[model samples]
Target: MTKSDFYRLCGGTFFVLVSNARKPIQSKAECYNGITSGLTEPEALLALAKTVIPDIPKPMNSEMKTLKDNTRDFKACLSNGGGFFRFGDQAVLKSFDVRVRQDYKQPLAAMNDFMDEFLDIKTSTKKDEYLVKGLVELLDADKEIGNDEIFYVRADGSTMTKSQILTASELCVQPFLLGLWHYVLTVVRDNKVGKDTYKDFCPPRGGAERIYTKQLGENSKREIAITYCDIDKTDNDFTEPKEHIPGENEENRAYKENDTSSANEEAASVPGTVINNNPFFLNISGGNNSIYNHVDKVEINHEARRDKGE
Candidate 1:
């Protein structure tokens, strides 16, 4: 379906009642102010299941709760990815991420295909207008290129045609944002950064960032430029190695006291840098060994509702 058609279809499926309320009227009310006047439970559930793009099994009470939870989780994912998206933010990016992560064995490939189809439908019509100019204007304005306005001129004349916008968003914005989310959630969350160095190694918040889309020659070879300033090394620097004392284990104590072999090996392994791989040995401040560097992964996922105390 085309973009408008897709939205209309989604909008029309509002009667699908997947809720905790068992009674028909309660379900109806919960669904949407008694909109599902004649829809039966089975029908409502089927529609609800269908409403989900790339449908999965029917949501039960707990699953319905999970869907609601997914909706909540989407925002935090978006925020962690890159603050927010202007339009179709959660619907396109987070929705795809959640569905693929929950059901598909491989998410990135599936998400890429999903976005491709999404853009194809949305951008079927091409205007003779100079699309690249609007694209540059949007990037110059530092606006989040969205799905619908993914094409067409905005009030400020700073938006690309659907085709150009989609290419830029997928290549530049989605990868960086989604990859940041994945890295933060999977890599940093799994104790990969060592508990002792957590405080020091946590990614610094905010940076001078820039992104732009470019077309090469008349062949329409498009590329996106992404740039960001590195965090100042002088502020809360993590590279400086602290003196590490040995642990209670006699072997470790002995190694620390007498063995320069491992240190030599590590230095050789990573030329021009000192190694502090041992967590128990670092000389960070007391009572802060297990303290996380940034917000907890679980907390980031669940923080939307919790922050509101809901």
Candidate 2:
């Protein structure tokens, strides 16, 4: 049977096989939680098969015998570093095969791609406020800002360590969601990174999106928060005018008017500031100041150069 078929019939049981060599624990045909405290990996496999087909031995024929004989071999392969032990599902196997073949410099690159897809497909349905809050919890930038740490790494090699990126005045905070998504995806997909990490690495997109996203978000909030913070600080002096109080008069209004005019002038004169409602200049800040520089244009006259052959 194919690996996917094996998983479908056997659940993802690993421990039961190794633990119980003689008395194979019968699986109640339940979805494998990837846990087998009292059971061995082989037993878990048996449990998984039973879950899929009540009378697995009768239907599976000689396959059941083959599984029983390979119990020791499976345990050994897993104990030794033989890469991930995959079973059940062609798409899952194919996706992993492709991921393995791709040359990724970053340790978490494949996981990040998976996560980006997950976020693009699943998290898009969430409300703006929920997404914003979810991002804050997931990245932990605010907490990390207080401690002064690197927030998260981008695929481009840049890091979001400072409180500035978290601020609305600086990078607008949304772009960093991509980074957080990458981090969570890696942690969840790799069994080495998490307990039962390999479990549900490629769950059905529509059927399990909410449950998976929520789990990943909740699990990753504290770690991400340690690296990033949302400060929203800006250098602009503009402030909203206060409402008139009982003692306030036209004199107060005149002062407020003057302040507004001066602030406008200051904002206009700021170097590298974009004109007329363009958001592109929003990236210009202390960290990115050096990126903007003037290049001198020299006008060369071709007629002024005489041919040496002449």
- Candidate that would win on lDDT: 2
What is candidate 1's local distance difference test score?
0.30
TM-score of each: 0.20, 0.23
What lDDT score belongs to each candidate, Candidate 1 first? 0.30, 0.33
Q: In candidate 1, what are the lDDT values of residues 134-203, reduced to their tens digit?
A: 2333233322223343321221213344345446632232222223223223322221222212112122
RMSD of 2: 28.4
Q: What lDDT score goes with residue 13 in model 2? A: 19
Task: Kindly report which residue pairs in candidate 1 clash with one another.
Answer: 151-162
Writing each residue's lDDT as its tens digit, candidate 2 over 1-310 gives: 3222212101111221112222333365542755444344444444322211222342145455555545433332222112222333344434433332342122233323222222222233333233344444323322212424443444343556535334423232233443443232222222232213123322345654211223323333232222223323222232324555545677787787797677657667755443332222223322223332332211223333433332
